[model samples]
Target: MSATDWIHSFDRFDGRKGIKPGLERMEAMLLLLGQPHRDLRFVHVAGTNGKGSTCAFLASVLEQAGYRVGLYTSPYLSAFGDRMRIGGCNITDDALDALVDRVKPVVEEVAATVHGRPTEFEVITLLSILFYAQERVDFVVWETGLGGRLDATNVVTPLLSLITNVGRDHEAILGQGIERIAVEKAGIIKPGVPVLTTAKGVALDVIERTAREQGAPCYAADRDFSAKRTAYGLDGQSFDWRGIGDHHVALRIRLLGPHQIDNAALALAACVQLRRMGVAITGEAMQAGLKSAAWPGRLEIVSQSPLTLLDGAHNPEGAAALAAALKELLPNRRLIFVIGILADKAIPDVLAPLTELAAHVIVTRPDMDRAAQTSDVADAVRTLAPTTPVETMDRVSSALYRATVLAMEQRGAVICTGSLYMISEARAVLVP
Candidate 1:
């Protein structure tokens, strides 16, 4: 089948319509596909916020260290190809088509036999593992799609389990509180494997206990690995690692915000652990990889004429971090914001932090079924920032244009955030 045809076939497997627990189906499918996940070593990353960034950094560092790396991340910004990368390049269309075709019959059989209709994420993840194995990847960095325990990617027993940070996301599936979420994410920790985590607060306690209970060595952030910021600029932020040794190196990461510094440090710490496990990574390679790592839609600046910043700050914590970064970068200038969000998120919580930094806000919806209404988002912003002007637009492109015009007229900055889906849509329109 053609690539577009294969994608269209899987698109029908949406709406959380068919999801099952246990790895039996995945295991059977992999076995039929020659068990590709077993051909390479893995570093599985699971968390709410920083999993994509952390996976990108780790894979880049490994590649710099002279290993062929495969990186699998989720919720692609553009094409489905963005979800799978081999040696820093997306999988070729030919490879994708072959893998999808090979797995189609097996997926259909599983769906028929066990009443398991695999979701789009499940199908794509299985394809990634199979393709990575076929290519003989030296190392694979896998990010969990949702909660770690029943996540499709959890079938692999990774060399190291890394949890970047835990927050209240996907509450209906992962659980409501921070501790519960931590437990779900900690499910990736395999027995005798070292689990590295940057979680703090009650979540930290939960993760520590889970690691200990599972007989996994726990490397908690601040206790086993830590980072302290030394400097920050538009160029990037510089930080020193304490537990990993006196590696006084600077990074020129394209991703903005102080949170990225922490994310980079977490990836560095994971590298140190991998080296201790005999991965052969060097200090020079680590420096280069950290500086070169780029995860788009996380405070990505697309334009300089009116200074447009695109960030995927979908939740409250992320939104707060984005606001702080904008304030730090443009202390004297006001901001015009074009924002959109998913219907499931708490609109007030997501908009409150961003509204504090906005001179005016334009609300819009992403081209997704789950997107929140633009009018509702506008009303919420008005409730928070009564004096700030608010406008509602039907599409992200229109909202982005209006915000840019306003920013140019006022000599201010335009910030696009709220949902990754929205950021992806806006990026395609504005950047092009």
Candidate 2:
């Protein structure tokens, strides 16, 4: 099939399935595909936040260490091909079409069987495993689509498992409270595998208990290894990571946000674990990868003059991190915000942090069926930041236009955040 045809077919398949969170269908599909996931080695990562950044850092470091690395992340910012990459380069359109073509027959056969049909995430995940195996990749850095235990990507028994941190996300599916959420996230822990996490408090206790039960050696971020920020700015941040058997001072990373230092530490700790598991990772490669790591749509600066930035702060924890970054980086400066979020997220919690930083707020809806209504978000803003000037724009482009004008007039920075969907559209508009 042509790439266009494949895209259309895949889009149709994608529309058919919604959030089927379990391993039965996935296991059946992978079994039919010769259990390719078992043959491949992976560095599996799961968490509410920082999974993408942590995966990016790990992949870059593995590639720098002269290994053929396969990196798989979800919810692509711009292109579907961005989900599957090797050595920092995206999978080609031709390759994607071919992969879909190869997997369609198996998918159809499974759909007709008692096991039932697999979801889009499951198909994409199986395809990634097949591609990584066919390409003879040395290691695959895999990011879970949702909560770990039941996520399609959890099929692999990874060499090292890294949970960046646990937070209240997908509450409906994963359950309420940090402990319940931590159990789901800790589901990725494999027996006898060394799991590294930056999670603290009740979440940490849950993970530790789960790891102990599974006979997995768990490395807590602050207890086992940690990163201390030495310098930070809008440009970049430098930190000291005290990792297992290695102490790297002044490790520089291009990604912005204070939370990223913890992410870098998790990545470093994962690398250290990978080394213990007989993977060749040098000190030089670790530093080089830290220097080159970057993930888009998370505190990303797209425009300079008006100082427009995009962040995917879809939840309370993420909002707090974004707010902290703004306070540290742009303290006492005028800040304007263009926000759009999904209907399912906590609106008040997401708005509270942005409202504190925003002199004026423009509420809008992203081009997604699940996006929260503009009026709903506006109401939340009024309740959270009563005195803050608010405007409602139905369209993202119009919201950006209004925010840009307000930022220019106030000599302030324009922040577009609340959801990854909005950030994706904003990046396509502003960066393009």
Candidate 3:
């Protein structure tokens, strides 16, 4: 089959809706493929949020340390090839086509079995493992597509596991409570593996207990390692970090927001453990990686005039972070928010924080089957802030345009948020 055909075929799984959250299908596929994931060393990351940023930091640091690093993150920001990368380069179309051709029969065979069809995520996971193995990558930074315990990426026993602070997203499949969600995230903690986390309170307790039960060494973020923000602005933040080897003073990161400093601390702590495992990650490499690591669609400033910022804050905690960042960076300025979210998210909770921060809101739906209806978002805004002006548009690009116009008129700033997929479309408009 052609590369385009293979890419389009994955839509059959209906994205996250077809998520099975079990290892049987993944295990069977890996077994038939002769266990390609077995040959690769990995750092597996899981959480409701910040997991992608943590993986970005880890992969960049390992690459700077002169190792061939393969990165596997789900729900690509832009392109299909973005899901899998080796040494900072995405897997080529030719290579992907070839890999799909090889695995097509095996996937069909497995589909014919009692397990039925493997989800799109499972196929992508298998493709990533096979590609990384064939390329002989020194390390793979694997980000779970969904919850940790039963995620397809969790099939591998990684050198280190990271839970980048669990929050209450994906309540339907993973569970509604923080403790239950924490349990799902902590499931990646394998026996004897060193797992690091920044989760606090009851979630932290759940993760700590899981680590203890699994006989894994647990490194808590605040207790074991921490970052104190020394300086920050639109450019980024400089932080002093402690508990991860020699304290780095004023480590600069351009990721934006105070929350990112926490993610960076988790990454730095992971590197410390990697060093203990004889990975040869030096201080200079860590410094360089921290400065250069890039994760788009999180407080990303796309335009200087009117100051258009794009963040994928689709949940309550994420929205709170975005609000805090806006307040810290541009205090006393009115905010024009352009937002869209998936149907599965806590819609009202996600929009509530922004209501207090925004001068007005433009609601639109992303080009996805699971996107929340634009009218629903408008209704939520009315409930939260009855006086706030609300605009509804059928298209994401149109909604962004309206917000930018309003921001320019008010001499304020614009924030396009709520869904990562929608921000991808929004970014194309602003950045392109």
Candidate 4:
């Protein structure tokens, strides 16, 4: 099938969506594809936020150590192919087209046999596994798309499972409270496998209990491992890792925010655990990888003209982190905010911290089915920042353009945030 044809197939599949949780369909699909997931080793990552960053860090570190690495992440910042990377490069169009073609027939057969039409995410998950196996990846770092237990990517039995922090996002699907959400995220823990996590609060307790119940050795941050910030600047963050004993190293990451330092620590700890499991990673390689790793769209400064920043702060915790980073990085400058949020997210919680920093706010909806309308988001922003001027634009591009124009007029920086969907849309329009 052609690239357009595959895209059309996915568009068609997306129309039949429902939120049923199970690995049965994915299991069947992978089994039909000769269980590609089993042929490769993986470090499965799950959490409400920071999973992509953690996965990118792990992939970069493993690659720097001279291993062929495959990284599969979701909700790409720029392109569809960004979801599947081998040796730090996005999958080529020809390879993606071929994999889609190979999977189409089986998907059709499954649909006809069991009335099981796989969702767009499920198809992408299968393609990632096939591509990883075909490329003979030494290790594949997989990030769960949503709640972990029944996610399509959970079909793999990982070398080490890492949960990056859990918060009150996706409440409807995961559950109402932190403990319930942690249990769902903890679903990725497999028997006898080692799990590493940065989960805190009641969520941390739940994950620890789950790991213990599954007979998995658990390494919780601040206990088994930790990252302490030595210093942070607009350049990057510097932190020290304490898990590898004599292998302790002071590291700097290109990614911004103090939270990123914690993410770096999580990745380093996971790498050390993998090495202990007999993976051929050295201390020198870990240092190089930590320094070189870059995950875009988390506090990413896409342009200096009017000083535009883009962040995928879709949840309360992520938004708070972004707000703190903004306060530290651009202190005393009143920020012009371009905001977009999803229908399913906790808008009040996410926008609370962000509203305090805004000199003016422009609300827009991304071109996505799940996007919250601009007017509704604007109304919410009004409640948070009553004195801050708020306007609504139907298109993200128009909102971004207007924000740049306004910020330039006022000699202020523009912050575009609220959802990954918006950041992806804004990056497409603003960067190019």
Candidate 5:
């Protein structure tokens, strides 16, 4: 089978339309493939929102320092091969096809075990590890596909572990509380491997206790390190990183938002820790890396005429962060918003904060298996923001077009948000 076809074939093993968290199948796959992760250094990252951005920042810094960094992030913003990258480039199709050809039989073998069939994520994790090993990358910054304890990527012990922050997300599978989610994410902490986190309050308590129990050094944000925003705008932001090392005067990032300052600080703290671990990184590289790092679909600006922005704010914490950023950045401006959401999220909670900022909203559904209906999303918006005008559109392209036109007429900004899948759909229409 063609590699693209093989990747698409994973839909058949969707596992109850969700994640089946465990390491048995992953372990069996590793044993059969001869443990490709051995001799490879890793920087495993886990969190509710900032995992991808943090990975991007860390990878870019390492790359700037001249290390061939391998980054593995989930739920690709564009294409399937976007999941695995070395030096910020996606694996070529020929490379992916060859790797899949070698692993397909092993995947089938793992499928027959008492551990049962490996899910798509499990196989993808295996493939990423193999690709990284074969390519001889300097370091792999691995992001968990789900909660960390049983995530396939968690099988590798890392040079360090980072939890960007914890909040209520994937509650059905990760359990209900923020602390529960924090515990699951902190599972990536290995014995004696230092841990850094931006989590606060109860989640901070959980992360600290877990790291203490694991005999890992914990660098908690606000306790060990803190960042103060120097300046911020739609283009980018600058912050002063102060903690866990010498103070950085002004670390600039293109990611956007105050929450991103925390993400960048977490990444900077990691760079300091990596330097202590014998990795050769310079101050110039850190500055340049933070300045140049780009993560698609997180407050990504795709257009300038009506000042359109796209963010993957699908959950409560994420939506709150986006809302807070817009409130801080735009103040009195009520934006025209085009939003699409997944069927299984806490719909009202996700819509509440964002709808508060909307002058007009067009609800739509992304082309994904579990996308919530546009009518359902519009109903949620109406309930949340009684004064805001809401409309339903089945197609993201149409929704974006309408939002843009209304934004221009009203002399307001446009925000395309809801989820990463939603932003991907909007990108196809808006970016080109």
Candidate 6:
């Protein structure tokens, strides 16, 4: 099958089977596929935010250590093929086409079962696992799509589990409160598989309890390891990571934000566990990997002169981090935003921090059906920052171009952000 044909068929299989979360369908599908994920070693990562960035660090560091690492992530910022990759390169189109064709029959077989048809995420999960197994990559840096417990990607038992942190993002799917959300995220913990996290307070308590219940030794940030930012700018961020058995004084990361430092610290801690598990991760490779790891569409500067940037800050916590990073990096500089947010997200909470820094906000809808109405977002912008100008645009490219022109006119920076869907469109328009 061609890429377009395969993608169309995959989308048809993506509908929700039932509201109640269970892994019956996923288990049935995998069993039909001959359980390909069993022979592979993975570092499963789950969290409310920072999962992609954390996965990037792990993949880069492992690759720097001369390992053929497969990295699997979700909600691709630029391309669908980006969901699965070994090191920085995506799987070839022909390979993906063939894999989809091969898996279609098995997916059909599962669709006929009592478990019913799997979602698009489930199909992608199966495809990625099969691809990794076929390639025989040394390790796979796996990220959960949503809450971990019933997520399609959670089917694999991993070598090390890393939860970046927990927050109240997916209230409808996961639960209402942070503690409940933490429990769902902590479901990635496996028996005797050492776990690491940057979570704190109630979230930390939940994860600790889960780890204890599973007999997985739990290591945490600020307790077992931590990152202290010494200096930061758009160029990159430099921090001091208190890693296991070593005091790494200066660790540099290309990814921006203080939150990124936390992610790097968590990944660094995971590296320590991998070493204990007999993976050869040298100090030199750790430093190199930490320095080289980059996650595009997250504070990625596509244009330097006009200072146009893109970030996937779809949730409140992520928005807060983006706001803080902007204040610290470009202090007092004017910011014009080209933003599109999903309808399911907390629009007010996502806008609150952003509107404070917005010299102007051009609201637009993303490519997804769940995207919030542009007018609704503009109303929220007015409520938050009444003085800030708001303009509604239907297309991400047009909104981004308009914002860029406005930013240049006002001598300000353009930040194109909100959902990954919007960022992906903006990236393809601007960078592609």
Best candidate per TM-score, number? 5
lDDT of 3 by residue, 1-432 (tens): 576566567644546565565898888888898998889999999988898888998888888999999999977887888889987888998899889988888888998999878877788888899999999999999999888998889899999999987888888888879999999999899999999999999989999999999999999987888889999999888998887555654588989998999999999999988998887999899989999999889999999898999999988999999888888998888999998999878999999889898898999989988899988889999999999999999898899889888889999999899999998899878887
Pairs clashing within candidate 1: none
Of candidates 6 and 2, the better by TM-score? 6
Give the per-residue lDDT of model 2 (tens digit) for 263-322.
988998888878887888998999999899889999999999899889999999999999
In model 4, which regions exceed 4 Å deviation? Answer: 4-17, 244-247
Candidate 6 minimal-lDDT segment of 10 residues: 11-20
Deviating ranges (above 4 Å) for candidate 5? 11-18
lDDT (CA) per prediction:
0.84, 0.88, 0.89, 0.87, 0.89, 0.89
Q: How many residue pairs clash in each candidate?
A: 0, 0, 0, 0, 0, 1
Clashing pairs in 6: 14-120
Higher-ranked by TM-score: 4 or 6: 6
Please provide, for model 1 over 153-180, each residue's C-alpha lDDT reduced to its tens digit, 9 standing for 90 to 100.
9999999999987888778767788988
Residue-wise lDDT of candidate 5 within 241-317, one digit each (tens)?
88755565578899889889989999999998999888999999999999999999998899888889999998999
lDDT of 4 by residue, 342-363 (tens): 9878998999999999999999
Error of 3 at 52 (Å): 0.8
Q: Candidate 1, overall lDDT?
A: 0.84
Clashing pairs in 5: none
**Pairs of residues at least 3 apart in sequence or in different chains that clash in candidate 2:** none
Q: What is the lDDT of residue 353 in candidate 2?
A: 80
Name the weakest run of 10 consecutive residues (lDDT summed) in model 3: 10-19
| Model 5, residue 198: C-alpha shift (Å) | 0.4
The TM-score obtained by model 5 is: 0.97
